[model samples]
Target chain A: MKAKIHIMLKNGVLDPQGKAVGHALASLGFDGVNEVRQGKYIEIDLAETDRAKAGGVVDRMCKTLLANTVIENYVIEFE
Target chain B: MKAKIHIMLKNGVLDPQGKAVGHALASLGFDGVNEVRQGKYIEIDLAETDRAKAGGVVDRMCKTLLANTVIENYVIEFE
Candidate 1:
C-alpha cells in the first residue's frame, strides 16, 4: 500500500520560511498573491494488510516523527 | 479561490532529511515502513477571475518562490 501524508503548520503558527518566500514572490512582481503557508508531504510504502493497522501505523508515525505536533497538523491518505 | 501547491524532489534526488526521518521511524519500532520522501505544500488564496490567470500566477509563484526547480517538481490545484 502507498500512503501520502501531508503535514502543515497550524493556522496561527509563525512560519518565517513561508513569509520569506511570500516576500520574494511579491518582489518578483507577482500580484494577487495574498499569503504563503508552508507544509510537508511525505509518501510512505507500507506492507500492512488491514486498513486499521495501516492507519494506526501512520498515526504513530505522525505523533512520533513525521510531524512536530506542537505546531503542525497532519493527514494521511492511503491507496 | 484556493490553490494547493505540492512540491517534491524528483525521484533519484538524494533526500537526506527524508532518510533521517525514516531512520528515526524505524528506530522507534514502526514496522512495514519501507521508505520516505518529503516534500512541500503551500496554500494560496487568489482573487483572479480567470482560471488561466490564476494558474499563470501559481506557475510563476512555483518558479520564483515555492520550489527550487533544479531538483524539485511542482503541481498546482485550483479551487
Candidate 2:
C-alpha cells in the first residue's frame, strides 16, 4: 500500500513562508493573487497490504513524527 | 477562486530530505516502510473567477516562480 499525506498549518497559525511566496508572486507581476499558504505533501510506500492496518500505521506516523499536532493538521489517503 | 498546487521532485532525482525522513521513521520503530518522498503543497486564493484563466495564471506561476522546472514537477488544481 501507498500513503499520501498532506500536512498543512492550521487556520489562525501565521505562515511566514506563505507570506513570502505571496509577496514574491506580486513582485513577479502576477496580479489577482489574494493569499498563499504552503504545506507538506508526503508519499510513503508501505510493506503492509491491509488497508485498515496501513491507515493506522500512517496515522501514528503523522501524530508521532510527521505533523506538529499543535500547529499543523494532516490528511492521509491510501492507494 | 482557489488553486491548490503539489510540487514534487522528478523521479530519478535524489531527495536527501526524503531519505532523512525515511531514516527517521525507521528509527522511530515504524517498520514496513519501503520508501518515503516529500513534496510541497501550496494553496493560492485568486480574484479571478474564470477557471480557464486561473489555470493559466497558476501554470505560469509554477513555471516561473513556484517550481524549479529542471528537477521539480508541479500539478495545479482549482477549487
Candidate 3:
C-alpha cells in the first residue's frame, strides 16, 4: 500500500515561508494572488496489504513523527 | 478561486530529508515501511473566477517562481 500525507500549518499559525513565496510571486508580476500557504506532501510505501492496517499504521506515524499536532494538521490517503 | 500545487522531486533524485524520515520511523519502532518521499503542497487564493484562466495563471506561477523545473515537477489543481 502507498499512503499519501498532506501536512499543513493550522489556521492562525504564522507561516513566514509561505509569506515569502507570496511576495516572490507578486514581485514576479503575477497579480491577484491573495494568499499562499505551504505545506508538506509525503508518500510512504508500506508492506502492509490490508487497507485498515495500513491506515492505522500511517496514522500512528503521523501522530508520532510526521506532523506537529499543535501547529499543523495532516490528512492521509491510501492507494 | 483557489489553486493547490504539489511540487515534488523528480524520481532518481537523492532525498536526504526523506531518508532521514524513514530512518526515524524505523527507530520509533514503526515497521513495514519500504520507502518515503517528501514534497511540497501549496495553496493559493486567486481573484480570477474563470477556471481556465486560473489554471493558466497558476501554471505560469509554477514555472516562473514556484518550482525548480530542472529537479522538481509540479502539479496544479484548481478549486
Candidate 4:
C-alpha cells in the first residue's frame, strides 16, 4: 500500500515560512496571491499489503512523528 | 480562489530527510515502513476570482520559483 499524508500548520498558528513565500511571490509579480500557507506532503510506500493494517500503521506514524498534533493537522490518502 | 500545490522530488533524487524519517519510524517500532519520501504542500489564497487567471499565475509561480523544474514536479489544484 501507498499512503500520502498532507500536513499543515493549524489555523491560528504562526507560519513564517508561508509568509516569506507569499512575499517572494508578490515580488515576482504574482500580485494576485493573498496568502501562502506551507506544509508537508509525505509519501510512504509500505511492504505490507493489508489495507486495514497499513492504515493503522500510517495513523500511528502521523500521531507519533509525522505531525505535531498541537500545531499541525494531517490528512491521509491511501492507495 | 484557493489553490493547493503539491511539490515532490523527481524520481532517483536522493532524499536524506525522507531516509531519516523512515529510520525514525523504524526506531519507534513501526515495522511496516518500506520507503519514505517527503515533499511540500503549499496552499495559496488568491485575490483573483477568475479560475483561468488563478491557474495561470500559479503555473508561472511553479515554473519559476515554487519548484525546481530540474529536480521536482508540482501539481496544482484549484478551487
Candidate 5:
C-alpha cells in the first residue's frame, strides 16, 4: 500500500519559515497573500499487503518520527 | 481564496533527503518502508476572490519561487 502523509504546524504554533515564504511572495509582487504556512508531504510506499497493517504502521510513523507531536499534526491517507 | 500547494521533485531527480529519512525510519524499526519521497506542502491564503485568479497567482508562485520548475513539479489545489 502507498500512504501519503501531510504534516503541518499546530494552529497555535509560530511558523517563522512560513512567514519568510510570505515575505518572499510579497517581494515577488504577489500582494494580498496572507497566513502562509509551510509543511511537509511525505509519500511512503510499503510492501505490506494488509491495509490495516499499513494504516497502523503509518500511524506509528507519524507518532514516532514523521511529525513533531509538540508542534505539528499529521494526517495519513491510505491508497 | 485558499490554495494548497504540493511541491515535489520530479521522478528523474534523486532525493537524498528522502533517502536519509528512510534510513532514519529503518533505524527506528520501521522496516517495511521501501521507497520514500519527501516534498513540501504549502497552505496559502490569498485575498483574491475569484478561484481562477487564485489559481493563476499560485501557478506563478510555483514557477518563480515555490518550486524549481527544472527539477520539481507542483500541484495546486483550490479551496
Candidate 6:
C-alpha cells in the first residue's frame, strides 16, 4: 500500500521560517500574500497488501515517526 | 482567495529527519514502515479576488518564499 501523510503546525504557533519566506516573496514582487504557514508531508511505501491494516499502520506511523505531537498534527491518506 | 503551496524535498535527497522518525517508530513497535520522505506545505490567505492573479501570486510565492529551489520543489493550489 502507498500512503501520504500531511503534517502541519498547529494553530497559534509561531512560524519563523514561514514568515521569512513571506517577506522574501514580497521582495520578489508577489503581492497580497497575507500569510504563510509551513508544514510537512510524508510519503510512505508499505509492503503490506491489506487496506484495513494500512490505516492502523499509517496511524501508528503518524503517532510514532511522522509527527512531533507537541507542535504538529497529521492526517493520512491511502493512494 | 485561499492558496495551498506544497513544497517537498526533491527525490534522491537524503531526509535524515524522516529517517530518525522512522527509527523511532520501529522502536515504538510500528511494523512495515518501508521508507519515509518528508516535505512541506504552505497555506496562504490572499485578499485578492482574481483567480488568475492568485496563481501568479502563488507561483511567485513558491519561487521566492515557499521553496528553496536548491533543495526543494513546490506546487500551488487554489482553495
Question: Which candidate leads the pack in TM-score?
Answer: 2
Off by over 4 Å in 4: none
- lDDT tens digits, residue span A1-79, model 5: 8999999999989999899999999988899897799999999999897999899999998998889999999999988
What tens digits encode model 3's per-residue C-alpha lDDT throughout A1-79? 8999999999999999899999999998898999999999999999999999899999999999999999999999988
Question: For residue B18, what is the lDDT in candidate 1?
Answer: 82
Model 2 accuracy (lDDT, Cα):
0.97
Model 1 chain B poorest ten-residue lDDT run: B40-49
Which regions of candidate 5 are displaced past 4 Å? Answer: none
TM-score of chain A of each: 0.94, 0.98, 0.97, 0.94, 0.94, 0.91
lDDT of 6 by residue, B1-79 (tens): 8888777788888888778767776788776878877777778888888999878767866675567889887878888
Residue-wise lDDT of candidate 2 within A1-79, one digit each (tens)?
8999999999999999999999999999999999999999999999999999999999999999999999999999998
TM-score per model for chain B alone?
0.93, 0.98, 0.96, 0.95, 0.95, 0.91
Interface RMSD of each: 1.2, 0.5, 0.6, 0.9, 0.8, 1.8
Name the DockQ score for candidate 4: 0.86
Q: Can you list the residue pairs that collide in candidate 4?
A: none
Give the whole-model CA lDDT for all candidates, comma-separated: 0.85, 0.97, 0.95, 0.93, 0.92, 0.79
lDDT per residue for candidate 2 within B9-76, as digits (tens), equals: 99999998789899999999998999999999999999999999999999999999999999999999
What DockQ do you compute for every candidate structure?
0.82, 0.94, 0.93, 0.86, 0.90, 0.73
TM-score of each: 0.93, 0.99, 0.97, 0.96, 0.97, 0.83
Supply fnat for every model shown.
Answer: 0.89, 0.92, 0.95, 0.91, 0.92, 0.97
Q: Tell me the alpha-carbon RMSD of every candidate.
A: 1.3, 0.6, 0.8, 1.0, 0.8, 2.2
Candidate 1 ranges with C-alpha deviation above 4 Å: none
Of candidates 5 and 3, the better by DockQ: 3
Model 1: how far residue B57 lies from native, Å: 1.4
User: In model 3, where do residues sit more than 4 Å from their true spots?
Assistant: none
Winning candidate number (lDDT): 2
lDDT at B16 for candidate 3? 84
Cα displacement (angstroms), candidate 1, residue B53, comes to 0.9
Of 3 and 4, the candidate ahead on lDDT is 3
Q: List, residue by residue over A1-79, the lDDT tens digit for candidate 4.
A: 8999999999999999999999998888789778899999999999989888888889999999999999999999898
Better of 2 and 4 by lDDT: 2
